[model samples]
Target: MINISRRIQVNAQSEANGVSLNRSQVWEGLVSKARNAVPYVSAITECNIVEDQGDRFIREVVLHGERLQELVILSTEQQVEFVRLSGNARGIIKNVIEEENGELYLRFSFDFSLPGVPAGSEKELEFATGMQNSYLDAVRSTLQTIRNKVSQ
Candidate 1:
């Protein structure tokens, strides 16, 4: 298995429009219309919210294409400050804010594991990397859109 962990930070130092949105607003926008908001996640043909309450949810997403994987995602919000999420496909993606010295910061960490193929397997690695990179890019793009929306 190949494990990939990536961290993306969205803080005052991050390039964003002059808009500040709490973690709740960001989480809402992310889940409300996931397919429309995130591009690469378009692979998710179906999403069933099995359990939905105030600050917690268990959602199953059916992914399509060359492979079919049902990702069961568990998500929880910590008040309005942060959100924690996990899925069968990945370890967890945590979106949290850090308040240090009167400065607010937003951060996202993605940790996941992928099936590994034999070394020097061009096709397999290519496909694996492509899918992983697409997911990562989608999140980054979504965050940019969120910032734009809040600015407007």
Candidate 2:
């Protein structure tokens, strides 16, 4: 399995524009992404909430042209976790909110393995690199979307 982790300061750019996102705003954005990721994730073409159970929900999303089902769990304003139920990747992906020196940060972490790829092969490394870049863009886009929402 390969693990990829990345984080970005949510208010880094927005603060200069006088639009910093608070904990609740970021949390709501995370929840919105969990429900309908089409806007936040460019790779996700479609999203549907299969089931809702207050703090957790099951969603089916078409990501990178592959239909995937995820069990999404919300941890109030702290974190949101997506566990892949059926997809090319297996394991969990997390979106976490952190505070440091009075600044807010959003962290995206992935722990998963491609079914047929060998752990220490070149192909795995390539996939990991590409996924890391793709996810980083997604995280940035998520924050930008939240900022736009907050400003409006």
Candidate 3:
């Protein structure tokens, strides 16, 4: 199996007034429409929640470039201010609204793995890492877009 991970911290403050932002509002806005997140997520060009049950749902997203489809189970926890999504054979993504040093921020972590690849195979690991690394720029751009779009 190949594993990939990244942590992105987004500043959540009003640029004009320097006021603290609302976590719930940001979360609601992000999940309200899957397309709203497309700009912030480089790999996913399309998002559709196929199933919904209040705090839990099934989302179908189309990956960019390759045009692959991935299905994920998503859950929200308002108390902890976090949203978690896991995909079969793909990986897991976690987004958390956090306050550090009295400043609000959004922390995003994504872990990816290929199910069938042998974990000990160096060649496979290298190939997988190279494949995922190609999308790094898109990912960074997506995060920047999210931070800019929301922090305004």
Please, what are the lDDT tens digits per residue for candidate 1 over residues 1-152? 33444445544445555566666666655655332322425565565565555445555555553322223232533212112233324344444444456544445444444344454467556755865676566556666777776677
The lDDT of model 1 is 0.49
TM-score of 3: 0.57
Model 2 lDDT tens row, 1-152: 98988888888864436778889999999999999999999999999999999899999999999998999999999999999999877989999999999988899999989899889899989988988999998998888888888888
Candidate 2 stretches with Cα past 4 Å from truth are: 14-16
TM-score of each predicted structure versus truth = 0.53, 0.95, 0.57
Clashing pairs in 1: none
Which candidate has the top score in lDDT? 2
For each of the candidates, the C-alpha root-mean-square deviation to the true structure, in angstroms, is 5.6, 1.4, 5.3
**C-alpha lDDT (0 to 100) for residue 27 of candidate 3:** 58
Winner on lDDT between 2 and 3 is: 2
Ranking by lDDT: 2, 3, 1
Candidate 3 clashes between residue pairs 3 or more apart in a chain or in different chains: 1-117, 1-119
